[model samples]
Target: MPGRSRPIDKFAAAVGKCSKESAVYGKCILADYNNVHKDKCAAEFMKLKDCYLAAYKKR
Candidate 1:
C-alpha cells in the first residue's frame, strides 16, 4: 500500500513551491534592477524569506 503523507512532507512541498515561484520573481526583478534601475534588490530577497515563512506558518 502507498504510505500516507505527513505534516512535514506537506510543509516541505509548500515551501518548495513558494521558493520556486519567489526565485523566478526575484530573478526578473534583480535583472531589471541590474540592467536599468541600478537599485538595491534587498526587497526581493526579503520577499523570498517572507514567502517561505508564510508557507511554513500556513502548513
Candidate 2:
C-alpha cells in the first residue's frame, strides 16, 4: 500500500473532518469546564463521536 496514510494520520484527518462537531461539543464542555458531569453534553458528544467515526471510515 504505497503512500497509504498511517493510522495516526488517518485519525488526525478524521478529526479535522469533524471539526465543526468537535468545536460545538468543546464549547458545551467549556461552558462548565470546572464541573463536568455525566451526560451533561451527551447529545453534542454523540454528534461529535458519530461524525468522527463516519469520517474515519470514509478515509
Candidate 3:
C-alpha cells in the first residue's frame, strides 16, 4: 500500500474535480450528515458512495 491513495484523499480529489459549487455542496452535505436523520443520511451516503465508485472507475 506504499503508493495507494487514502480514501479521504481520493474523496477530496474526486470532489475537487467537480464544479466548485457542487463540490462545496457535496462537502457540506457530508459534513452535516451526522446531524441528519439516520435513514436519510444513510440513503444520501449510499448515493454519494456510488458516485465515488463511479468516479474511481473513470479514474
Question: Each candidate's root-mean-square deviation in Å?
Answer: 5.6, 1.3, 5.4
The digit string of per-residue lDDT tens for model 2 on 1-59 reads 88878999889989989889999999999998999999999999999999989999998
lDDT of 3: 0.63
lDDT of each: 0.70, 0.93, 0.63
TM-score of each: 0.45, 0.87, 0.41
Worst 10 residues of 2 by lDDT: 1-10
Q: List model 3 lDDT by residue over 16-44, tens digit each.
A: 55554465446767787768554645555
Report how far residue 26 has shifted in candidate 3, in Å.
6.6
What would the TM-score be for candidate 3 when compared with the true structure? 0.41
Which candidate wins on TM-score?
2
Q: Which pairs of residues collide in model 1? A: none
What's the C-alpha lDDT at position 27 in model 2? 97
Q: What's the TM for model 1?
A: 0.45
Model 2, residue 46: what's the lDDT? 95
Which model, 2 or 3, shows the larger TM-score?
2
Error of 3 at 12 (Å): 3.9
Candidate 1 local lDDT, residue 17: 62
lDDT of 1: 0.70
